[model samples]
Target chain A: MLEYVLSKYNFWTYAILLIIGLYAMVGKKNLVKKLIGMNIFQSAVILFYISIGVKKGGATVPIFLGDAHAAHGHEIIIDAAHYFIPLPHVLMLTAIVVSVATTGVALAVLILIYKRYKTLEMDEIMKIRQDTGA
Target chain B: MIWQLDVIFCLFVIICAIAAINVKDLLAAVIILGAYSFFMCILWTEMGAVDVAFTEASVGAGVGTVLFIAAVNKTKRRSKD
Candidate 1:
């Protein structure tokens, strides 16, 4: 039981963060809070994917390990066990870029909203929208 | 198993995350979010995710927080509950 708990505890940590982010997204009244929650959720997922690439003391980072036995004066990509998986890293590169872009755009839109509405509260914005019909 | 470091770092990350969301001041919340990202970035490094960690360290803590603060400055710094 101890072994099982030790091996799987990271999963539980990530799961708790997932729930926290979800709650922030659903329960927060401010749009920026929701955006921050989305970022937290994305980071949790990225961490989970990276954790999947780890092995039980079997792998190195995805790079050539040595010059003595490398064939064709080059290293070959082996199975998942001997090297950390690179696929998730590549995907997360794009995810990070997209997240930054989305945050920038959202912030810009938020500025525009605040300029017109003169308020940042979601409830206030919605009530004003109903009154103005625009 | 040396799970001790991971466990400690995980607890810190969780605390930072919770504090970031719960703080009433928007600026303080954004700054705490950056701290949370930094802690998570270090945790990712321990998990052998150098690239993801780099991205989080740069984008999540740096660019994301700046953008959030800029948005708050343009709007109201106070949140109505």
Candidate 2:
């Protein structure tokens, strides 16, 4: 039990974060709160992917630490044991930028919604739309 | 893994995230969320993801927070629930 718990503690931590974010996104009344919840959800996913790339006992950055010009075809072999996963890092980099962009767009939309309805509450907006037949 | 630092930082991240959502004030929530992002960046750095940490610091903690603050300024401060 101890070994199992120790080995999977990181996953448990992230799971808690995911649950918190999901609750905020699904249960919150404010539109901005939903946006913040989206941020948390994205961050949790990014962190999980990044953690998946980590290895035990031995790890190195994915970049070629040695001479590039003197490289040979025979030395192109990938030693998976020591090399870090550059793929997830690059993918998550793209994801982070995309998340920022999407958040900006979402916030802009929020501004428009607030301006039109004079409130940011989801229920209030829904009621307003119903009343206005919009 | 350095259990001490990792445990502490992870705990801080969780606390910040929870506080960010639970606080009634939207601006305070945004600030707390920014702090959460900073803690997450540091945690990623400790995990040896320097590039991810850099991106998180610049985009997530820096620009993202500023954008949130701007949105909050434009919207109502109090939440219905």
Candidate 3:
């Protein structure tokens, strides 16, 4: 049974990460905490794509002569190809950058909120908002 | 190396998520949300997404946890939970 379980480890891991990320994003009331959940959720998706590119018993995709067997029997093409697709890596590079930029912007917004309200508690802010009648 | 430990870690992530959602205190909820990110980092590693796992560990577990705490500090501790 354990052997069987190990065979599909990637899918199981993806499911576990995705669910945890979702719970954090949805179950929390704090806005910053919710953003943390959002980051986890995005990371889970990134992991999913990275897992899609894995190939058992295969080497990284690059245009090279490779081993003797490959050189003897395989034909070289200018367009690099391999057992696993490299598209996921390219896409994830963009995604990682974007996620970082988003985090920075979120922090900036949080700082602004703190300056404007002079308190970090959501309830206190709300209470003040009610008092000011603005 | 064996992968049994990975499966156990996956189970632990699920439990953490469930407990995070179930916890009554909003602060507790935020802290558990950080735990959720930590477990996700492990899951990404098990799946052979080492690059993604690194990014997630840093941003998700580190920056994300900090953001949540900041947001919590700005809000009421009392939640519907």
Q: State which candidate has the highest DockQ.
A: 2
> Could you give the interface RMSD of candidate 3 in angstroms?
4.5
Is candidate 2 or 3 superior in TM-score?
Answer: 2
CA lDDT of each candidate? 0.83, 0.88, 0.66
* Tens-place lDDT digits, model 3, residues A7-122: 87757766766776687667654555555556656766776787787665644432244576657766755433344556786688678768867876886786687778875556
Please tell me how candidate 3 rates in CAPRI terms.
Answer: acceptable
How many clashing residue pairs appear in each of the predictions shown?
Answer: 0, 0, 8
Q: Can you give the TM-score per candidate against the true fold?
A: 0.90, 0.92, 0.60
lDDT of 3 by residue, B1-81 (tens): 235777687677767766666676767876876777677667655555556667767876677667656655665455543
Residue B62 in model 3: lDDT: 76
* Residue-level lDDT tens digits of model 1 in A1-134: 98887778788788988888898889988877877788888888877887787776767677656565645667565576777887888898798889889989989998898889888778888999999897
Task: Look at candidate 1 and give me any clashing residue pairs.
Answer: none
Score chain A of each prediction against the true chain A by TM-score and list the results.
Answer: 0.84, 0.87, 0.74
Q: What residue pairs clash in candidate 2, if any at all?
A: none
Residue A80 shift from truth in candidate 2, angstroms: 2.9
User: Residues A1-134, candidate 2, lDDT per residue (tens digit)?
Assistant: 97786676667778888999999999999998988989998999988988898887767666666677777555676578876777888999999999999999999999998889999998988999999998
lDDT of 3 at A82: 43
